[model samples]
Target: MSKFGFLKVAAAIPHVRIADCDYNARQITGLIRKGADRGARIILFPELSVTAYTCGDLIQQPTLLNAAEQALGYILSETSQLPVVGIVGMPITYGNALYNCAVVFAEGRIRGVVPKTYIPNYAEFYEARCFMSGEEIGFATIRMCGQETDFGRNILFNLDGVKFGVEICEDMWVPAAPSVNQAVDGAQVLFNLSASPEVIGKHNYLLSLVKSQSARTQSAYVYCSAGYGESSTDLVFAGNGIIVEGGQILQRSERFSLEEQLVVADIDTERLITSRRRTTTFAPHRPNERIIVEISLPKNPADTTLDRWIDPQPFVPGSPEEMEECGNEIVNIQTMGLAQRLEHTNCKKVVLGVSGGLDSTLALMIAVRTFDRLGLNRKGIIAVTMPGFGTSNRTYRNALALMRCLGVTSREISIRKACEQHFADIGLDPTTQSSAYENAQARERTQILMDLANLEGGLVLGTGDLSELALGWATYNGDQMSMYGLNASLPKTLIRVLMRWMAERCKDDAIRQILIDVVETPISPELLPTEEGKEFGQQTEKIIGPYELHDFFLYHFIHNGYSPAKILFVAQKAFNDRYDRGTILRWMRLFFQRFFSQQFKRSTMPDGPKVGIISLSPRGDWRMPSDANADTWMREIDRLIEEEK
Candidate 1:
């Protein structure tokens, strides 16, 4: 959602003073104003924050209770100026019972009130002495600013097309959360108001819980918890405010700060709809009990400027440590997968073409690692270097050096002579060649690898990557076909970065120097002739745009099923300083065009390990229809591009 989505929500943690209703209301009102100014359609506050969570025993007093009710009325009235929906926690009296509730307000009026169902009676929470559990109640109408207000969680706020519901403190940590029942009743956004006291090493646990719940429910969750103003008499509160979409916490505030915190994140309602449609498990609620409250919604503006933060690196997670761990996991997944395949085939060697490029370099490294794990000789791995029409002297020399440094058997074959023989047999001119010109060289290289593997009784490892496979960029039945694909799930951007990282960490000087140079080298298919003064031949970025941008596009497109319009919208935001809208849209169109047209290629991809949540492995993550038309997708891009101009 950080990169691309339609829903914009914010969790605003305002500084509060214990038992001071007036001061807390003013702070909450300021946060609401700032959120509305930033284009947040929905805002949530902490639980029972009208008088502060640290006002523990003071909550039993009649004076504090009356002040809290008055402050609630004032907030509902003052918040009508902003075009947003806000949820604030307080105590409410219903049927001679005081219950903790989150009062939802919008446009200067009370819209709904959701009572907390499970009140904590254990530990230091003496809620059983002051309040009662939520009793069975229908969607009753209450007066707010002379209009009927909906009261209950059965209330779904339908703004434009986004439907949202609310949950109070302690609601989420329960066995069966109130949000689950609300989701079953068609709540797209689950707003939780919490005041959990912070403890040693509990913030990370809370983060995992929030993220996993959002993922499990396929909903946008905005959690606003009490910050520094709570009672320090017995516990401490970190102004914890987080916004999560799907399974990832897009943003979080600093811990244990005495200041107000605000986190804004976008949730793609359109993409969420697609997920629900494809999930097969998401459906309408058939719960034991539910309240039906259809509240009035704000109008959808024509040009809503979603002022949400977008991550620079979408595939990589946040924090340096997390990213390193993730990299290790993906590499292990790849190596282990290849090891099993080799064991099943009972092959003592793996044959692969080493071009000193990212894909081939990664494949070779994996082959060496796999052989070492099985206690096989390094010389048992046969590394073939095929110099073709576009093979630069730099790349050719690096390939040989890498093999020698790794202590693996190496061979150099000139594809120029082999392809000249192929062209003569097929009655084609060496000068007037077409696709037949390019593919002939590719097929010859593949033939050499396969034949060499047969001679050594080894598996032919495929070096074609995920990006190549996705765009049908590889030569069919040539480089695209392999017994075991070690690099199929790795994207081009990640491939280069990972190679650079490996180069930085490798103890072998020869391999490290080659990897570093290859990372700096221009990415090419090497199909065209390097006849004249060209430094690098047939660069892929010249046609496909930057791999960095395309990898971003791929993550948003397939991972979330985002539409072309949305993808373009997010791309502009994510690369605003780096790439202009025109270039981004141009690549976006190519992405949709190539992705849809290339399904046939992915449908027959070689077996590879699914390294991440998003992959195009037909045997595992991705299953696509080869006949999917690109017309609608193309038209969407065309229309969006024209509209932006």
Candidate 2:
């Protein structure tokens, strides 16, 4: 069996009645069993679930407190047979004061108790009137329901592989939440048992709160609130529940549901841990006042089936409006970054090779915008098109037309003669189409661009994108070397969108038509000889898998650090009816091999602004040894191949 890095967790909103301890306990116990059966290792209930949050002054009654304790004991006994670890909210009396608390229990035993740090006393809330803050008690040992439990604000439960901390309602609403301390104390997940009443527009605020806290703490946060059966005399309890991991909300419950609701999600604990490890800004361990309770989970296999949303295009938005907005923002970022670079360098002109392809076209457009932003003349942007053996008429015409229409200094330099001479000098035949033949053209074009920049007192702009860098598709020291690269951070999949967006915004009809044709043209190096006519026969996508699949693989592999099995599984679901499993796996294996081999190209890459999370810039987002072995990864891929067969 494959070891899963996910922990199946659930937030349960059980039906509650005010001060009805027995009924609430039954509801709680039943949910525990259901969650356990569904493979939830950790299940959390709403705040003050034993006696509903709306109990009001009845919380002061000794008889009601005693009944709550008895009902809790009944729940513990009933759940002893299950393997689920639970956090149940109640009010516990220690010394001469009562503190609202969440008790952690597993295998029929109370592991520890955590008190509410902040008690809300504002409108519609009077918690401060009836409960003492957990901060007041610090740490204590309290005997209750025939067992002595470690009680206080300083308590954490680390069981098997999941270490989590507990807080209550208003604790999350206050600044500097206990969850921050809990995360600093090595809590991978934070559970908030809440009884917050729903007001107008509070759900959106609460949802943002949970997401921000999870992002800030770099931990998974599960929140559950009191439900419909609670006393609605003053405020309505709609039972809002949420589960978030790494700033992304995985699941949220429907509000105002009368039935018992359980929101379950599989949180990737490995991914969270990896994020913390990668980020050096996270605080080290502090002196903890909480007791650490260690528990052993059952021997059942972990659930490998994920229940979270795995976006097919993690870098691109699915909505058309959002796509346009994202495209505009990305172009702005690229242009602004280039503009700043140019101003800092005090360069007189900008020179770049324009292939009339997506990447080069985007780079050319950015150069124009940068010079325009700096109030420089359009002639300062030198756009060069080097037509080689396989150059198609369509792309060559588009490149020349775009340059003329954009009012830049256009230059046409054919690399066929230079490449033939270089190939002959190297004792290679120019008639044979090979890597040498192709790379010769690329190197010759680069040399011409570099020389032109030097003569013009400008900088040579690189057009290789992130996707190409990931797959090592650029020729080393040929197209890979540049003074400054504007498209280094943009992926191939997104570059097409930016091209179309630029066309849409173009004022001149000729320039717009040229940009549209460039977007429609097939991506290729145009270094090999065409078949009979000037049509493009060396299409890049046919050689490398589709950009969509490669980009998807790159995002999940580098950004999310997902395993091959998980990536393959999600790709099957995301690209269902489009690409079969065999095709995805074949391309995935190729991706891993080339990615490992291509580190040399990215290791010495030029300076470029990082526009996204998955930049291959060695100085910024990624740094890997060029010689690192991929045997371990290949073994996993082999296993997947066998399974698919």
Candidate 3:
């Protein structure tokens, strides 16, 4: 593994000539060289690659078997000088039984050989006719091609601190495959040498299996299947190469290609280790009486680029279909949570403060949906628009337009008079636009919402989102305090996506247009005085860095438990196109500072439904001390800045 915990691996599908050991061995050697050139520490090949999986009954002949062994010896000799491990499938004879096995070799020496556990005797497969199952064959020694090595079904090879195990084609299809035991025995990566023929819809099912298996084992799975040049008498082999880590496919080879294919990707073993450590239920089972073979390879260069996708908007879904499904589910969750709350409280009304911002807009929509679901009158869902000093005309108009279009009971309550009175009572100059002046408006708005809810027997719905809570941007005892916060678990980046999705599906054109305008409006608390003719006086992103970056940091830091340095490393890659290194560093420092300093606000945050994987609920998902220090995190960022200089 690299210093960053990344191990570069490759899945190679070489074009082969059936039963022609010489041609197949040359092809395998060439692919290994190519994979090594691309910085792959371990290169894997398909099952029976030495003589080709299509060599039907030729496996029973001693001449063919000896030729296959000779071919493997040739491959080992050719690629021995290269500092990379190569795993190829061939038929091995031991004690009057031929076993279809994966031979692992590195630095011109045989590391180990893992036999296929499950022999398939199904309709399309007849492997049981020639080879015996290696399930009962525990740790044993085997001699092949003038090299003695450990041979069994329970063998794990370790190269530079990365432990990987291998299984054959049919072994992975069974429920009790050897990989489970291998993983339980502390294997961080798994490899499958497969020759399964392709049929209609089989590729999709195979892809799903790869994804699910990697996810289930919480390890990197590299699978290589036989491809072009295999005998096509009954079934065709479309070289399928897939590399997955933690259920996500890092790379997949193009199927049905006639050329030799090699899919290379860097696996993050450290991330997998971290995940396993976090999960309590990933219990250790009956450990394999495993044999470990260690091989040391040269360390990867420090300047090596990562070969994985780093999502910029980790909170938002990746694809359009995923976005649609997730958006619908999120809205349903919000509405159902609110609906249940209202029903439990026996309240037919909800008082919400709408500022035409993303958070309030989303909360108002949820309230309307909840009221509709509960069969309550829309007028009872009071949406109060409190225009404060920072309230811009665009947002004010959009708020009114949305309320009018949605047919909610809209009330325009100006907080100017209330805030002025409060400032005078507190003996503060009204002209001084301090935090007190800003927080006073927020407090006054909350007071109106609270008083109105009490008079109407309703709940004060909060509009403060996860981002605001993370940054402590909301006012204490003001916007931060509500009877129920609808968007507490929802982040700002996701709010934009959900709003856009709702707008596209909205039936009413006017309501849809209003929602669109609200989504496009700049995010602000509207607590400061607005400049003349301006839509927003203070931009939230300008004050506290971009929500996209913050959400990314929050996801990795809290959900993935990544340190500040690793988070910054990935963040620079994720947002390299939009943000420079210095810009990302600047905001990342603020994120840690604000995230640690603002825990007091989050500690006392109002009750809200946990919608996503990352939540700051003191009662549920996240619980942190209010006085946790961030000096260590800050020092890391400071060191990074110093290194940059």
Candidate 4:
């Protein structure tokens, strides 16, 4: 029904004089229509944006409060003709109480109103003097458009097939936010109407809070705060508008912009459900103190003709200075984690199988750095080059050369004869290649490393990557088993680039050469024999899609709580020049399938440090059931793809 299976949302900050309801109502109508024309299903305005947030004691005036209500009804009447869900803020009086509330409008009518639960009477804010905190968890009805409408933080409005909730400004700044409870009680998206003023270093803190809250609650948070339109007699308002999902901030408005600014983003319902399904701690609350209202959205829910641009490099820091700082911090975290593990085990030597590939190369590099930190001899690290049936001279030569150049204990063990002997012992033909044939070679290599580590009293450093573990690409008890997988937390795509970076920065010329050669080398396990007596091994990318695409899929799906539909949406945007919509959907389906099916491999994974937000280490960030069915997930993808046709 829509171009994309997504919806656009907006956060608007308008300039207006306080107590001037007529001008405020006109500005509100103009913004609502503009948002609707931009395909926004839900538009969030700042706290008390209808009239103003800095009304002070004037909020207690019956005439000012009454004008605000009349302005809300008039604005709703004008823009309600367009299909949009708008949340406007105003001061209201009901049943011996005056409250700062977010009034909800949809489908040509006022649906409900959610009053602020926590009124801040601190430092600069003094809402307590004029408003009552709606902390009591019970049902209350109020007059809206000549009818009763439910009002509470427990009230959830459903639009565009998502269950949405609301919380005011200060409600989010607390340790346990109202949205946190709402998320547990089945709220997938939380909207905050705020009137926060700007201070030195306050912007960064505000963004961090939004990111942390979104991640903690596993919900998409749209934060719309008042702009410079609010009185700046004492403090300034930057109108920090942000949209966050999971832990990543997807969209943020231009701060201090004089013109009215709107930042819009879609909240993925499917992704939130998937994440909540996987995480046991996200245990949904019982049917207690909850309200579910079905609010109708536009028939075209996915027509995202939004003026939004997707950042191609989302994981990479936006600024060069920030990127360098982040790189240093991440490297320290990684090397430190490895150092502690080695010290705890009293391991003097580390055994690693050098394949002249990204994962192994990274692990080897980290090992060298760790040894340097421990002041141990580089020779104590044994870098083995095991030539198997599928081994190529290019890879084999690089592996042995790297070990020799680094002055590590190097050993070359040809596994061709050993695999033949293994096949004979198993009573199978060596020529009969299958999963068993590939797995046999892998298991033999692991066995040799394990035995070598035991004989030398060294830790078997793992080379498998996060992507492999996510896809179950490793043979069980073969590449999957290790004493400590140094590169287990690094995604395959990132490691490839990191290895290149490390090589360029290395002081040792010999080590640098080998590392560069490894980066240029085609990725493979050398499990299958060389292609018809030709040179190289089977390419992993040929079997799986490019690691860059997979890593992109991994990040969005795991970290951002992006739905398969939304994943496909942004993937199409990010990789449009390289991959088509259909190609992305194909690999996307594979990603979900493999990620769900490979939980068993991660469940018993070796110890590894989590360098990023998403980690497959079972003991750490994720603890999904190994035997859970992927049918529901697979079905969602299938249904989306079918509808796309």
Candidate 5:
């Protein structure tokens, strides 16, 4: 069992009773065992949970303090056998003053105690009256249940390679939080035991604060707040439990819950460490006042099972409204980008090869919209449909209908005669349908488009989408070459959605109908010839792979820099219902093989406006040498294949 990388953590909201140390201890112990059973290595409790945060001035009394200390011993002993680290809140006495603190313990032993650094003194908080801030204290040992334990605000518990730091309720609210220093000193997870009271609209603010803080610190943050059992005299505690990693919330509990709330999530510690290591601006300064406690967590297999959402289409929105809005915004971006180019160049026209496929259809639509936006004549947006050996009737009609319905000047030029002549001139067999035959058609189309643009004083707008570019599906110096590619940033799955959105939203009935047909048409490059009377047979997905899987692979590969094994593991989960493991593996291997080999194609790609995170613009987002080897990547894939066998 390999034990590294991922860390399973929990945020526990135990039902508390004010001043009833025994009952609180039992509640906290129960949640700890539950978290341990669920494979949570680190479980966190709300602030002052041992005696309850609402205990008020009872915190100053000796009897209550003694009871809280005894309850701590009870919890430590009860959770001794569990292979987990528990962080619970209580009040401690060092000298003549009492302080609010979180006790970190594991295996029947108290590892350390982290005192709250910022005591909230204003606005419903009077911690200054009963408790002292931990700022003045560096490190000390206090007797708890006859055991002298480590205590300080700067203590970082190192459990099985996972470094965790602690902060109290108000610590996160301040501008310069103690978590900032702790993270800078090498803490991957920041655990905050909060007792924040619920107001009208504080949840949103608190949620945003956690998100921004996690992003800034580049660490996983687990926050658990006091729940319904506290005193409700002046305020009501809503029990908001949140587990965030890298600024993304993994799990959140319902507010005002009467029962104990426990939210468990697997945080990717490896990702956090990798991000911190890569960021040049993250400078860590070692503080001499901090102590690192080395503890051991149970050596178990790293759990790849995820309880969070693995969105199938990470680039596209999930909701209908958001999808529509996204489509609108994408179109606006594409139109605006082209509009800027046209205005700056002051070109006479825009020329593009309309293949009657999704890519060309989208590009043609953008050209029309851009011309409209710039108040240029629609005839200047020349839409040319180049018929080849594989042009299907369905797509052919849709393309012509779309061009005519949109009122753009359209023309047709067949490549069969030109390709045949070229093959004869090259001494290649015109009867044989090989790559030469297909590529001949593609190159001929490019030649015609370029020459037309030059003659008409226009720019030849490229019509290939990002997925095709990523997989290197385009023929070199043929469809791959363009003056300005508009859809280069969008993936195949997104192009489908955008086409449908346009169809439904278009006010022109004829154009709307034509676009609907275009959305339903199968994606094809139309390079190979069709049967005697059948439709075009060169389906793009059938030759390469499903666009959905390819796009998924591209997003995780380029955006997150995930390894091949990790990408396959998550893809199996995301597409379990749709695709089998063998099919996924095959396509994933194909994706990597093509992506690495195709860098040469992307290395010299034309300029395109980037609309999303996953862009292959060589000069802008991605820059790679054309000769980078793929041996290590392929060897990993081979290992995955062997494992499957």
Candidate 6:
């Protein structure tokens, strides 16, 4: 494992020759050495790989079984010097019964053996005819290749401090998989040696199965299957190798390739361990008589780089199809939440403020949809564009255009006079761009919306997003207070994506163009005074760092419980081309500082729908104290900054 708790593992598919143990041994050994060279600590091979799974009835011959054992022995001796734990499938016999087993070996020693618990007798499977089920066999010791090792279905191999379990082809397809028990017994990784034949639509289903099992167990799952060179008399073996962690596919091998394949991935064991701990239902069950064999692997150099894809925009979907689906779902969620709130209150009117920004534009769109969904007139949904001291002509024009095209009741409410009068009453100069000056404008606009909601018997729709809430960008009791927050769980980065998607689906060219411009506009609160010939006086990212970076930090820190240092490590890799380590650390410090200081605002935040996995709903997902200290978090970041210097 690296300093970040990443365990590099590989799933290998070696070219095979049916019943030719010596040739298969050479192929497996070469792949093992290659995996070791690539820094893989654990390498897995397909089921019955020593002698190809298609050996059929020849599997019953004593000569073939002995040859398989000799092949395993040769592989062990050949790769004994490498710092990798190799698991290979072969037939093992004891007490006059043959069992399909996964033999674990490292440093020239057979650590342990785990047998297949479930035997398939269904279509295209006749494993029950040759091998006895090892489910009833509790725990025992067996001699194989001149070494005595624990042998049973209840055996786990411990390399260094990490424990992993193994299962065979049929064991994984059954309802009661041994991996579940192994996970409960504190196994962090699971391996499966499979030789599943490919059929129509089976590959997709198999991928889903592996993903679900890894998610269910909260463990890193490494699966390898027999590929080319397996006899294809009635079935074809499309070599399928997959490495999954916590329901996400990290890497997969190309299927039906004639050459031997090795697919490697770095599994975040720290994330898996943290996930299991957070999930209350993932508890230990009835104890089983399991044996854990401790194998010491040679120490390797620590890895300085990650070989996995780290998404810079975790909230935004990577693919276009997924973006379309997720965008529609988020819109539906926001629209439905507002619709339900409107129905519960029996109010057909909703009062919202539109600044031609991403958040407000999205909220306005949802309100229009809600009114349409309820068969109410669009005029009932009032969209107020309150021009303040910092309002820009570009945004002002776009706001009016969008409200007009959407056919909502557009109102222009100027807060300049109101804020100036309040400034005079408070005996303060409005010329100074202080916190009070900026916040007074926000409070006055909120007060106007509140009174209008009362006059029209409507609800004040809030536009504050998750990213703003995390940074405490909203003034307390100003824009933060709402009847119901539709975009509370949505982040700024995602709001832009959703608006773009909505623009593409829009039939009105005018409204679509306005939406597109709104997405391109820089994000800001428009609280300061605007100068002539300027788009806006203030930019949010300039002050709070990029929303993309904050969203990435938020997901890892809150959703994955990553430390500030670890978040920096991954963030550096994710945004390496755009940002350096120093810039990320600088902004990360600000994130932690604001996140801790702004708890009081979130503590009293209004009710909002939780749309995603990461939420700051104090009453639901997150419940941090209003006065939590950021000293420890800051110290870690400070140390990293010092290292950079």
Give the alpha carbon lDDT tens digit for every residue of 1-645 in model 3: 376688888999998998999999999999998887888889999999998998889988999999998998899899988878999999999898999999999878889999999999988999999999998888899998898999988789888788999999888888987777777788999999999898898889999888988999889999999999999999899999999998999999999998899899999888888888888677556665778898897654432767778899989988999998999899999999999898898989999999888899999999998888888899998999999888888988889999998899999999988888889899999788888888888999999999999999999999998888888888999999999999999999999989999999999999999889888887877777777776568988898889999999898888888888888888888998999888888999999998999899999988889998878989977889999989999999999988888
Q: What is the TM-score of each candidate against the true structure?
A: 0.93, 0.93, 0.97, 0.82, 0.94, 0.98
Q: Model 6 over residues 423-524: C-alpha lDDT tens digits? A: 999987877779999999899999999999999999999999999999999999899888888889999888899899999999999999999999999988
Give the clashing residue pairs of candidate 6, or none. none
Q: Give stretches of model 1 more than 4 Å off.
A: 1-5, 135-155, 282-289, 299-304
Cα misplacement distance, residue 426 of candidate 6 (Å): 1.0
lDDT of 2 by residue, 240-289 (tens): 88999999889999999998999989888878888888788886665677
Model 1 sits at a Cα RMSD from the real structure of 2.8
Across 155-197, the per-residue lDDT of candidate 5 in tens digits comes to: 9989888888999989999998999999988899999999999
* Candidate 1 CA-lDDT value: 0.80
Candidate 6 TM-score versus the reference: 0.98
Looking at model 6, which ten-residue stretch has the lowest summed lDDT? 298-307
Best by lDDT: 6
Best by TM-score: 6
Q: What's the distance in Å from true for residue 451, model 1?
A: 1.9
Over 1-645, each residue of candidate 1 has an lDDT whose tens digit, in order, gives 223447678889998898899999999999888887767778899998888876766777879878987887778778776777888988776656777888887877777788787888887687777777664554665543355666654666676567788887777888888787766666778899999887788888888888887888888788989988787888888788888878767778888776787777667777666777777777854664555544454543421676456665576656667767877887788889988998898988889999877789889988888788889898988999999888887778878988998999999888898788889998988787588999888888999999999998999999998888777888888898888888888888777777877788899787788889989888887877886887777888997888878888888778767777777777778889999988988888888788888888788888888776677988777888989888988888888788878
Each candidate's clash count: 6, 1, 0, 0, 0, 0
RMSD of 2: 2.6
Better of 1 and 2 by lDDT: 2
Pick the winner on lDDT between candidates 1 and 5.
5
RMSD per model, one decimal: 2.8, 2.6, 1.5, 4.4, 2.3, 1.2
C-alpha lDDT score of every prediction, in listed order: 0.80, 0.88, 0.89, 0.82, 0.87, 0.90
The true-versus-predicted C-alpha distance at residue 481 of model 3, in Å, is 1.4
Better of 4 and 6 by lDDT: 6
Residue 303, model 6, lDDT: 41
